[model samples]
Target: MSNLSKLEFVALDISGKNFLPWTLDAQIHLTAKNLGETIIDDNETSLQDKAKAMIFLRHHLHEDLKREYLTIKDPLELWNNIQDRFDHQKLVLLLKARSEWIHLRLQDYKSVSEYNSALFRISSELKLCGDNITDEDMLEKTFSTFHPSNLILAQQYRERKFTKYSELISCLLVAEENNKLLLQNHQARPVGTNPLPETNAISTRSKHGRGRSGGPHRGRGRGRGRSNTWHRESHNTKIDGGRGSSRQNTGRPHKGRVSGDKDNICYRCGMSNHWSRTCRTPKHLVEAYQRTMKEKGKQTETNLIEGAPNSSSPAFWSDTHLEACDFIENVRDV
Candidate 1:
């Protein structure tokens, strides 16, 4: 009934990706629905079902994405068409991600956390491409990601050969914290100014390093060691027809992380899972969100609504039948 999976929507929205398993699962789920099973049949009803699936796919896709397969009418053919494209497309993406990983120089970023997060993001992309980087490789990457100024300290780390990444990170964090304290103590600016203008400058530098060369070294450990993953399961389990267990994968995982909860996240709203983008949210739920936000008084419903169509939501359709399937992706700046 829906177009893309939660993971696929997030992938497309966040990284402009389409994890194969997620998309395949969505198509499979759709075809398993009413009339979907008869897509291969030759009867009028079967043809109707296939057409319905085709409509579903067309309806769910962001406006721009539909153009590629616009002429294809068969549901399975459309699915195959998309899959064929992605087969080549994902490989290119994988290459690009790997290139980023290989060329990532620590001197590029300013903060350790920022640098580490970027590195981990690359790591995640590598995983998506079936490249399982080892723990040692990760550690080596971490060690390799220091600014030239920290070379001596990094050299010392090589000599020390610390057993735990966390332990090493802790030391680095302590050192960073101490450095900040010293910087504050020796602040040239007045008290009214920022205590650590130097740190702020570093942060700015780190953020701007995108598509640039040298990456920044982490002076401190702001996050835990990257051993744990993004998945967290519900403690509450229900028995379904004497089946083993029933659970909901509620929380959204980060880009690099993977937890199979296709039904959870909505690709449209870019928020919580368990809802479809095409379906309007329940009134009660909308009211609840409104109440919560009204108390906070920040963003509102207007922010989420699609604005007037621009050049991006181009009119590809000449026929009236395709109108219901038309989708606008709600263009936004990257």
Candidate 2:
């Protein structure tokens, strides 16, 4: 009886798994072709229309289903018989849809879009089953299912008294984007690592560049540097003798030091090869080095003194004292 060459929609299976949507598609297509009345009992549709409707219905049925209803010719009788066989699908689908709706929660998804898509899908199924979900219900469901940490945010959103779910979703999406942007900003610089002010930046770069470029040391004796260098050379000689020729061949001048270990460098003599704890430099020698730095700092402060009438002012003294203390603390931390 299936004389049509093309399928208008998904064919109804023998188990009637897609019975609901199949019936909907069948009705719409039949109506469009002027054969809709043939499927309604006592509608007085023409014989030609009935034959066309019957052929359309049979064409959209599984091969097994067509054989099962093989003897049915009248479209109305065929529609009623199919309905009687698959009508229980509505109640079954309704129960499944209700269960899914009850278990759905916004917090279960990582993003708002995913949760929104699931909400609409489940809501559509419920609608098809004669259960309509209102906008207020959707908003409440979303609000109630927020993660515990966002309870305050959820309350604030609720206080807005949004009447439509789309409006609430729009606000949530905007907030989500803002929060993501905030995290990116924080990660770009992070706390306690901000760039120094322009003056400080230039001063720091000049100081390090002078040391690396072997510029003449200011307000410091060359004797101390020569003594420190001799002590390190002698220590390396001792290590090479103690460890034997095999290890000596591969050992570096400062075995434990590398360029990346800047923080572990000696603060006393500005040596990058060793830490202050094991520095061979004498205590008084270290003290002299610190005093030299303090004098240099004071000389700079004298050139840039501000907020004070003269160097004798209490404000000037306070500023100098603070700078000295900061220098001491930096050395002590090493």
Candidate 3:
């Protein structure tokens, strides 16, 4: 009974659904047996029950609407009066919704997906307002709204029959993805790619294989160990065929030096007569060398801080260190 008292009337239309005064009236009549509405006709008690139901229906209405219903004592008349006023409001709301649908555009949204979603939302609103929209009509409207550049594709799609709206949307998404991929491929070369002349790969592979095996093919060291190894060639092709010229050699190998003996090669500058440590032509080499030294210093400092052999510095195995340094130099060359 207390819950029933809390059921206030609220006048709101749900398109085709039930609304306020209707809900209040139905609740009262359904629960009337408990409220004593079944007792007598035109009697004081019966009138009181009907009055109670009408008051609940009228309680939450705005002042102007309430005043209009005040002259009607019966619940049914009050309901009819409220409907007459709200029906007019519904027409005004429908007009506003239709105006929004007319002004909506694909350009207002950031992407194809967002534009499509907004178009559907406006179409749905218009439908609720009594516009009889069909999927085929929606498909044509959506295609017409695309940007002028995209409209060409929309027209191409029109040439086909039996294409659903969903299929068109899927096609648009696929085309968008393909365009992005093509743009990406155009902007940057992929990794591990040597797009330079095919000869560079052959020359590099030959040098690499010989360096790894330290074999006779490379003059069998010719008494020229790691120190007197073959020098860099004239062409310093980039690993990825990128822009910018290769690092210049500081000077030509002293006129008649054997090409197999690159003992004094400056791997960083592709120059001979000076080692990488001595070469100062390439600025990047200086930075990398400094960075390597700093990292070594930091490692020594970390060991001391952690209380590991604080008395004396750690010793490096010469052979292993040399091999590791060679590997690093090879990577920098690439």
RMSD of each: 41.5, 22.6, 29.1
Write the number of the candidate with greater lDDT, choosing between 1 and 3.
1
lDDT assessment of candidate 3? 0.56
Query: Candidate 3: where is the Cα deviation over 4 Å?
Result: 1-75, 160-334
Badly placed stretches (over 4 Å) of model 1 are: 1-56, 64-76, 159-171, 188-334
List, residue by residue over 1-334, the lDDT tens digit for candidate 2. 3437888689999999899999899999988888888887679878888888888999999999899889999989999999999999989999998999899998899999899999999898888889989998899899999999899999999999999999999999898889899999889864755553333111111111123223355356554332111122232233333322212333546453244655566888766766675566655567888887777755433466545457877767776655566657576676
lDDT of 2: 0.78
Best-performing candidate as measured by TM-score: 2
**What is the per-residue lDDT of model 1 for residues 43-110, given as tens digits with 9 covering 90 to 100?**
35566677767766666565666766678788777666566656665687689889998888767876
In model 1, what is the error at residue 306, expressed in angstroms? 95
Ranked candidates, highest lDDT first = 2, 1, 3
Can you write out model 3's per-residue Cα lDDT over 5-57, one digit (the tens) per residue? 55344443434133433444555653653443422234344666676666655
All candidates: TM-score: 0.40, 0.55, 0.38
TM-score of 1: 0.40
Residue pairs clashing, model 2? none
In candidate 3, where is summed lDDT lowest over 10 consecutive residues? 201-210
**Global lDDT scores for all candidate models:** 0.59, 0.78, 0.56
